[model samples]
Target: MRGLSWQIGLRYSMDRSGNQLVSFLSRLSMLGLILGVALLVVVLSVMNGFDQEMRSRILSLVPHITFQPWQQDRGDWQTLKAEVEQHPSVTAAAPFLQGNVMLIKGNAVEPSLLLGIDAAAERKVSRVGDFVDLGLLEGNREGLVLGDALAKKLGVEVGENISLGIPQSSDSNDVRFAKLPVLATVATGTELDQQLLLSSLETAARLLPSGQTLSLRVSIDDVFNAPRVAWELASVHGQDYIIRDWSQQFGNMYHAIQMSRKLVVIMLLAVVAVAIFNVVSTLVMVVNDKSADIAILRSQGASQGDILRIFLVYGAVIAGVGALAGGVLGVLLALGIGDIVAAIENALDMKLLQSDVYPINYLPSALRWGDIASVCGTAYVMSLVATLYPAWRASRMPPAEALRHG
Candidate 1:
């Protein structure tokens, strides 16, 4: 009967008292399968999390697209901003002036790039301002906002006066100097904290040399198609304007995430392959241990097809149980990874991801059903393949020879 094939295969895999080695091998194979699948799922989910953070946090802080005059300062920024938002793809636009300057707080002088922004308009295109508790440039003319790390380097605090020096190429070599107080110190937990200096556009107008060009920051509805959208905007704005996008500003990070994800998946798949290959060894030992029993079944009119089906079922059970357990475990781990990281951090009193080296200093993870399905499918296919050689050998065994040897 069909049920007899299933019964014999199941008994062979589970009969520990008769042959300890076969039972041990079966358990080892299942354990390997479980570990391999679980690891692949967790690693893939973490990569997915990183990709999401790249799009959400990093992309939100930077401009999806930027447009600037190739010739000189675009004094009519108000007009340009309005024109940019008219496009269906363009969601928001803001004006910004940026230049290099030296910051001086007593003897602690640091080189910095100062960004002059319209407080109200800048908020439309970027959430960098929201990361901080205080408005570093709000209502404070001739005041500066220092990034947390920059503030630490300067050894200064809010309401402290800092001097800014700009290079002035006059008839004689003279640098223009202006003094402004620190409006606020902000910790964005991004690379922006390293060398950012924020000031109101009006303050920058007085502090920097005359004729500094302003660049337009633009946000788009479709982030992935930013380059194409930016090019379209540039075409309408005229050829004299140059455009840049987040892809250029933060592409290395995005590309690294993608490349790492591909490489890791490949490596883990190999691990899964190795684990799956162990199924062959497991089935071989099971067939050997059950040779006499197999011969008995043959003598009792069991067909070769029945013998093959039995072993196949045995291997499938190992693979199916292992895969199901692993998939469940991996999803649970990935979803609760943030809490795990927090617990570890609290116990060790140390930070895992440093903000200076990474985009954000927190653990992020996401689990997708598609990834789990792939892991399970790969396991099932490999397990089925591993059973073929052993199952075939058992099916072709001569009942007389197997009986004589027994």
Candidate 2:
């Protein structure tokens, strides 16, 4: 009975002779499901890629945690750095001095965060050392390492001198200015390229009133655990110090990305659900058109359960084929989307992502099998559920009444 039902259901699904409208609607419903599932997969993969790129590019260069004195006077930074490094979660610690200042070159002026770092020590905590030769700032008190974007904006190049204007006090407008030569330029492919200025720890100390005591920048094994470790360090060895982490600086952006990803999932899932539900209309049309055939089958001793199973199989065939095709299309697109975007950018001779405005000037994609599986599975299940009402209606229709109507 099951084999007979399956064979008849498949034949009916393939037959387009009786009603052209029903066949067309069935194909349209399957097409909608395919498109919805494919788009969802591609979008989710891109979101995953963006999240990964942010962690690797921005978070890798920024300090995971920072410890600074609460008072204006510099504290014992060496002892603090050593203590931070002793923690099990801490990977490396480096000393740095930072100040908010303005850069001047000719008529152009830009605000920037002036960071002073010990080149060798910085290499342990940051990947900035890989981009620029921090060693150049060692003995050259007037040397600076500017982000490529900042240098371009200032119309300055390596060996060109730019003036650094540091405010004497937060309350007063008195500013101390010094001329420093650009030693090198670093391209980090992030927003840092717009407003970061790098110098030696000694030079940074000279620019600010805090002479010798520097703040410790710590890197940890797991970036997500930075807040807990920072608080622990603060409570134990930082009674006179303040604790800060990368989350304080970039948490909002990270959270925004996560929120957008979730919102996109919900919106796209609704689209998929709508497409799946379209199958209900298609199946209802099929049930009405096949009423006489169903009546004949019942007269031949086919049970109501057999009739229901036949339509269920018909719906499953449509959904299963669409899901499989969509998965294949989605996987191929996700795998090649990066190259496709790059080619489009090349042909258009334009940049979709500017490094100064966006992190890493390229569209990225990272396909996960789990996402594919979940999307396909959910779509198939929804499609099957949509078939239930129409299938039940067909199964319960009295054969005598159906034949009389036929």
Candidate 3:
């Protein structure tokens, strides 16, 4: 009987001799589901890619944790660095001098975060060496490395001298000026490109007052664990230092990404649900059109349960085929969306993402099987549930009335 029900259901599903409108609606429902699922997959994959870029590009260069003196007594930076390196979560540690300064070239002036670093030790703590020309800073205390965007804004180039306006004291209006030749430029494809100035520790010390203490910057294996590790390190030193973590600096951006991802999922899932529920309308039309056939089957000893099962099977076949096909199409699109967008950008001769505004100016994608499974499963289940009402209506129809109406 089960086999017989399957055969009948499949035959009805495949039959195109019936009303043309019914067949068209069925196909349209399938098409909508395919489009909705494919779009969801692609968008989520792109969001995942952005998350990856944020972690890799921004977090890699920004210190995961930093420690600066809160008291007047400057502690031994080498001892602190060595102690930080001994932590299990800590990967590398380096000493740095950070201060804000204004860059002046001719008539152009721009504000920048001046970071003084040891070229050799900085490489161990961050990927700054990969983006910076380390050779230019080596043994060149009077040289400076500007972020590409800052350099462009100042109309300065490599080998051009730029004046640094450093504040003499935090409380006073006094400003000390010094000139240094631009050694190189760093292009990090992030906002850092607009505001960073790199120089050797000796050069930065010369620009500032005599008694500024060096701070420790530490990188860890797990970025998310930075806050906990930072506090633990602070506790060991009896709270004499100020502890800062990456989250305090960039937490808002990370939260924004997560919030955007959740909103996108909710909106896209609603679209998919609407597409799947269109099957309800399609099945209702099928039930009305097949009343005469349904009456004949009932008169031939087909039980109400059998009638219900037939329509359920029919709906299942439609939902199953549509969901499977959509899943396959979505997976394919998600895997290649990056290249597709890149090709489109090239052909159009325009940028979708600007380096000055956005982090990493390119579309990226990272397909996850978990997301694929969730989307397809939700679609299929919604589609299957949508068939219940029409199937029940078909089962409850009286054979005598149906035949009389036929």
Candidate 4:
């Protein structure tokens, strides 16, 4: 280290450019790094937030698995339930009636899916009890819970009577409707906000005017594995009934969330990569300006490999510093984005993001360690690679040629 002092000092001094042009380039490199990392972090965090929101909103409303009868009133109800309950994965089971019905209130008609569920047993599988506010389902057989958005659309409220009209199946064409009393309203964000309603299985079946057959609604301990478990249940029970997992029930929404996340990631990465190219160009210019010093070192026993490594190490250091700073900035921005947007919106006296219009009301973020680590590591690695060609060319310059040019 002592013997190499002069060379190290020379190299350090040569790095200090005497012009504002070089200063501007240095600032630009840092700026590019900052922008790249900040955007990457915030984008990934927002995607994570959206993904988490999807699961919370969707999973809370529906059961993990539904054992549907192949046809209405088609199978042995009690025996199938007993066989399905025997599976280790199945924690709770209850019979249900699923049918489409029309809601009629004083001449206004709206189509709605009528779900028949056992009041007491449905609680184990669905969050119907939490959704109920006024009338107890046990006391009233015709009681129903409407989604808040749906209720708004239909102009119905708690304790109001809404006639549920189930279309007659036979071609005989007798007009009949099942009139049910509204019990409560449920609020769950998403399209489910507008369509879903809850009612007793007895009421649902009665509304259908169809004979009751036990179509089981099952809840398993592991929700992510619901599809596999549902298939297992079907396999074990000989597939007499149609078994559906939550994934199948909400396939389109699930795929849309995944695609959105991927698209966001891709776009962010493309932006970051372009910014990183600025860092590459800046390092290349620095190498070009130091060619004479590099040649002198080559003459004084510094191997080509050592010169290459020294510049590579310097680039790595710069990248590491930039990445660390950018990551900190990103996390801070994400964590405070809600407050920041809220302040902006309040000052303007307008809503920036309305939940009714957008899925969420504010800028949501989730700063995950995995995403941060991946971004930082990738930036550092790219910076290191960016140094290679420039550093190699600097080290390979002939001493006679470099000194004459200088």
Q: What TM-scores do the predictions have? A: 0.91, 0.91, 0.92, 0.81
Residue 315 lDDT, candidate 1, scale 0-100: 83
- Compare the candidates by lDDT and give the number of the best one: 2
The parts of candidate 2 lying over 4 Å away from their true place are 138-142, 210-212, 343-361, 404-406
lDDT of 2: 0.87
TM-score of 2: 0.91
From the highest lDDT down, the ranking of the candidates is 2, 3, 1, 4
lDDT of each: 0.82, 0.87, 0.86, 0.74
Number of clashes recorded per candidate: 0, 0, 0, 1
lDDT of 3 by residue, 265-308 (tens): 89998998888778888999899889998899999988888889
**Candidate 4's residue-wise lDDT over 1-406, tens digit each?**
3336444534542455544565577567767787788888888888787777656655756888877666665787788778878888888888877776888877677888877777788777766566564235565457788877788878888888888767666575655766667878877555566777888766676667556566888888777888789878878664567778888867666677679888987887777777678777776776666677777877887877777776666566567767888888988888988788889999999987654555555666778999999998888788768768876776687878878775
Q: Per-residue lDDT for 184 in model 1?
A: 84
How many clashes in candidate 4?
A: 1
**For candidate 2, lDDT tens digit of each residue in 214-297?**
888899999989889888987896778888999999888889888999999999999888888888889988998899999999
**Distance from true location, Cα of 320 in model 1, Å:** 0.5
Candidate number that wins on TM-score, 1 or 2:
2
Best by TM-score: 3
What pairs collide in candidate 4? 117-201
